[model samples]
Target: MAEWLYEAGIGENRAALVSRGTIWKARIELEGTGARVGAILNARLADRSTGKVTLDGGGEALCDPLPPGVTQGGPLRVRIVREAIPEPGRPKLPKAVPSDALPMPGLTLLERITASDVPVRVCRAHEPDLLEQAGWSEVLDEAVTGEIAFPGGALRLSPTPAMTLFDVDGGGPLEPLAVAAAHAVARAIERHGITGSIGVDFPTLANRAARAAVAEAIDAALPQPFERTTVNGFGFLQIVRRRTRPSLPELLRADPIGAETRAELRRIERLPPPPPATHMTTQRIARRLAQQPGWTTELARRSGGTTQFVSAKE
Candidate 1:
């Protein structure tokens, strides 16, 4: 049976798509990142330039040429079709249309249950480790330092401003390991919600036949529609995937100042509740944690333990 393991935490919301007890995909939504994908916003055309329309209240979104008879700059109802992602440039809201004329709502991370055809269940919050068992926690950590492992080898995932890159590592037979890396890469991409341009650096393999085998493995692993380059002699393959929302790493690693602080708090939640008392972290982390209003109390409430933070000196 498939289940949607959900945890509504104080700082963020998370969900895991699991099939037969193994998590296939994971999602995280942090506070302050507006939920816009399914949001119906009242907007007016503020400006238009170079194939982009700036909405009055909603920010600029790239759009196709406005259909004839549809003029710009009037009270228009617009729905956010595609969300803005940090990589490969800003969001090009390619599917905004007249709210009166619509087909159906878009499926989003926030609204997966209703949109999904699979049987779904909301996991209990007390069992935070339910999703953690199936590589969920490791991927969260990988969001900070992009390390992922397969049986024979491992790959590191890092996103540059232009594209996300996957570098293959570890020891094994070149062709077989490259094939394994390709499979692992596809799984990691799905699990991490990675999209946009991606470049995979497989270990150098001069033989075209061997490279063909690796490509086949990748195609089998990731059935999602994507445009990809053939593995060259230098062992580099580039793929460009459709971007929907901010990836897991992009959402988590967005601001260094808050990332570690939020991560530590999450770690603390998973621990067996300490005696009802004060807890301490480094002064830097403590200060960041303090910035999140009401989180300490919320954590206490959810964990069934009371934790108070007192100002500390270095």
Candidate 2:
């Protein structure tokens, strides 16, 4: 039976749906980010001309369809349609629309998984790690490396501001590789929770029937609630899905040092007592770990040993 395994980690909440001894889908919610999607907030209209609103806290949002007769700098009720997306230099502001509905808090990771109607098994620190048993770390590696392997080929995922792209590569006939890539792309899409626009570049096929076959494979593999273009002569296909929150790659790549630190914390916490006093790593990773004392404290509590830090030079 398929079940959702949730772990309230130190800095983030992680969940994975597992069935048949494999992970079908996964999600990670980093705590203390910005207002999540589906949150209703009272914001001040920062600019009527641009329809920008300042959230109660320290974030800004773009509000569409400005409320009628709402003066500039006036209070407005808005619902978050999309969470702020993190990028390299300039991150996108949260998107919202005017709403008169009652205020409501956003759903947490646990709530979202429970809403899926699947049996949820919450994992504790000292319990047998079900998520790791289900290849959770391997999935994280795929997200970090952006390489997903299928039967006959592999897909390289690259997430960009405008769209996420996938390039198929392997040693095989173009037809079978393309077909296999189509299904692999579908599975990866769900596994990573990739949203917004996505592009897949398969081996170019001059044969129209072969392209149709690839498109058919995509249709049969991917789930609904998304729109995709047919495979063209260049073997490029575009897919668009409703994006509310950041995907796995977006979360990890946005702050690589932080991701590495979190992974290290996970490893240290799982070690059978008497973990190393100091973890040696790059300066950036060590600095990031120092910034979050609470996380280190939690790790100490879980591992039965407090952790110190040392840079590679030391």
Candidate 3:
């Protein structure tokens, strides 16, 4: 039976759907990403014409279909429809719309996973790390590297402002390679929690029949709830998914130092009894750990040993 295993790690929360001792799907929620989806809050109309509003807390949001007769600078309630998205230069703000609903905080990662149809298993520190045992680290590496190797070839995922592009390459017959790559592409998208616009570049097949076969492979592999164009003569297919939050690649690549810090914490927690007294690593990692006192406290509590950070420089 497949179960959703959730871990409340320091600075981030993780969840994985595991079956047959393998991870089928994984997700990570980083701390302080932004206002979560489904949160209703009060906002002051900043620009009535543009439907721009300032959240009561300290963020900007675009609220469309403004309530009737809402004046500029007037307080109005809004519900968050989408979380902020990270881009190259500046991040896109959370999107909301005017609402009369009561104000409430968004659901936490744990709450969301438990609400899923799959059985939920909350992992404990003292117990074995089920997520790691199910190949969590390898998935993280794949996200950071953007390289997923299949049997015949590999898919290079590149996330750009416009869309996430998957370039498929392998040595073999064009038809077979395209078909195999189609399944691989679907799996990668699902594994990485990739959403929004996506483009897959497969080996061009001149034969109409070959293109149809590749399309059929994609339709069988990828799940629904998405819109995709037919494989064109150029062997390019476009897919669109509902975008709310940043994908896994965006999170890891955006803050590599933070990712490393969390990974180090995971490593330290896995040590045998009487864990190391102090962790010696880069100054950046030391600073990151120090900034999160709660994380250090939890690390100490779990390891049953005092935790300290020393710069490797000395």
Q: Would you list the C-alpha lDDT of every candidate in the order shown?
A: 0.72, 0.89, 0.88
lDDT of 3 by residue, 7-104 (tens): 87878889998998888788889877567889999999999888989998879999988999889999999999888877778877789988888999
Cα lDDT for residue 48, candidate 3:
84
Candidates 1 and 2 compared: the better one by TM-score is 2
Ranking by TM-score: 2, 3, 1
Q: Model 2, range 57-130, lDDT digits (tens) per residue?
A: 76899999899988988999999999999998999988999888888877888998999889999987677888
Error of 2 at 21 (Å): 1.5
Instruction: After the best TM-score superposition of candidate 2, give how far the Cα of residue 70 lies from its true spot, in angstroms.
Output: 1.2
> Candidate order by lDDT, highest to lowest?
2, 3, 1
Q: Tell me the spans in candidate 3 whose CA falls farther than 4 Å from its real position.
A: none
The prediction achieving the highest lDDT against the true structure is 2
TM-score of 3: 0.95
Candidate 1's residue-wise lDDT over 1-314, tens digit each? 77777766667778888887777788887775542565555555545443355555446655444434545675555566667665334533434544654333445455765467765556554455777677676767877789887899888989777888999998968988999999999998988888889999999998999999888888999867898889998999988888768788877766655766766667677777563477677777788777875787777777888776555673
- By TM-score, how accurate is candidate 1? 0.83
- True-vs-predicted CA distance for residue 187, candidate 3, Å: 1.0
Top candidate, metric TM-score: 2
